[model samples]
Target chain A: EPEVTQTPSHQVTQMGQEVILRCVPISNHLYFYWYRQILGQKVEFLVSFYNNEISEKSEIFDDQFSVERPDGSNFTLKIRSTKLEDSAMYFCASSEIADTQYFGPGTRLTVL
Target chain B: GESVGLHLPTLSVQEGDNSIINCAYSNSASDYFIWYKQESGKGPQFIIDIRSNMDKRQGQRVTVLLNKTVKHLSLQIAATQPGDSAVYFCAETPITDKLIFGTGTRLQVFP
Candidate 1:
């Protein structure tokens, strides 16, 4: 079965630095999403992308966060400046339609 | 103020037994619900899903029951095995693409 894949399984960055988490969604999927889970917390939605544009975003998806579908298969989430609280497991998910999204293994972001 | 939450934080079951994980949602507009299993260090894996139009759906060894009146959902795993040990989460969507996940329930299946 085809699955969503993410690069840099684990990332470590200094506070105030930038980090880009990359994901290659299932080839045929059109809707992509980013979610984060703090340790011992529930997963929270960040943003959703469709048609190469942001369809919706949550309050946590502030100016520091941006998502881009630079290519057909590559979808990336960039944090302009990392904060200690921003450290969490970031997951990329995609679906052929608006339902049943498939999730990637996730990228663990650690900011010190 | 919408939230999806699990009723239990952890559950233990013996192998060959059945497991039922419960979830409750405060959003009445949520029309879609999904159950996902996440092993340690891995992402959430799709187990099964049920739409509001339906009350029950089954897939493989799992069955999902949704009660819109009570705004509750449950995932039933039949004949649980040691491999079934994982954290189970129930997510809901209110006509949008983004899923609101629950706190998650850790299932421990022992042999």
Candidate 2:
């Protein structure tokens, strides 16, 4: 089965540094989402992208966070300046419509 | 299939036993519910899903039950094995299609 794929399985960056997490969602899917799971915490939604624009976002998705579909198949999440609390497992998901969302293995971001 | 939860609320079950996990969703507008299993170092894997219009749905060895009145959902695994051990989470999506995940319960199977 086709699955979502993410690059840089793990990322390590210092505090206040910029980080970009990349994901290639299923080719035919139209909607994409970004989620993060802190260690020992529940998965939290960040933002949703569709038609090359952000359709919805959460409070945690503040000024530092931005998502881009620079080109087809690639959905990127950029953090302008990272904080220690930003360290978590960032996941990318996609769906044909608003139905079931398929998830990627996730990229572990470690901010020190 | 043997009975589970012979001990505390640890959610540990014996291999070859059946397991039933329960969840209480928060949204009355949520018409769709999904169950996902996440193992260590990996993302959540889809198990099964049910719509509010349906009371029950089955897939392979898994079954999902939905109770709209109570705002509850449950996942049942028959003949659960050690490989079935993971953190199980229930997610709900309203009209927005944004999935809200629950606090997962760890399923640990004993040999």
Top candidate when judged by DockQ against the true structure: 1
Error of 1 at B24 (Å): 0.5
**Which residue ranges in model 1 land beyond 4 Å of their true spot?**
none
Instruction: Go through the candidates in order and give each one's DockQ.
Output: 0.93, 0.70
- TM-score result, candidate 1: 0.99
Question: Cα deviation in Å at residue B92, candidate 1?
Answer: 0.2
lDDT of each: 0.96, 0.89
Candidate 1 docking band: high
lDDT of 1 by residue, B1-110 (tens): 79999999999999999999999999999999999999998999999999999999999999999999999999999999999999999999987879999999999998
Please provide TM-scores, in order, for all candidate models, with all chains considered together.
0.99, 0.95
Residue-level lDDT tens digits of model 2 in B17-78: 99998888767888888899999999989899898999999999999999888777888999
Per-residue lDDT tens digits for candidate 1, residues A36-88, read: 99988888999999998999999999999999998888999999999999999
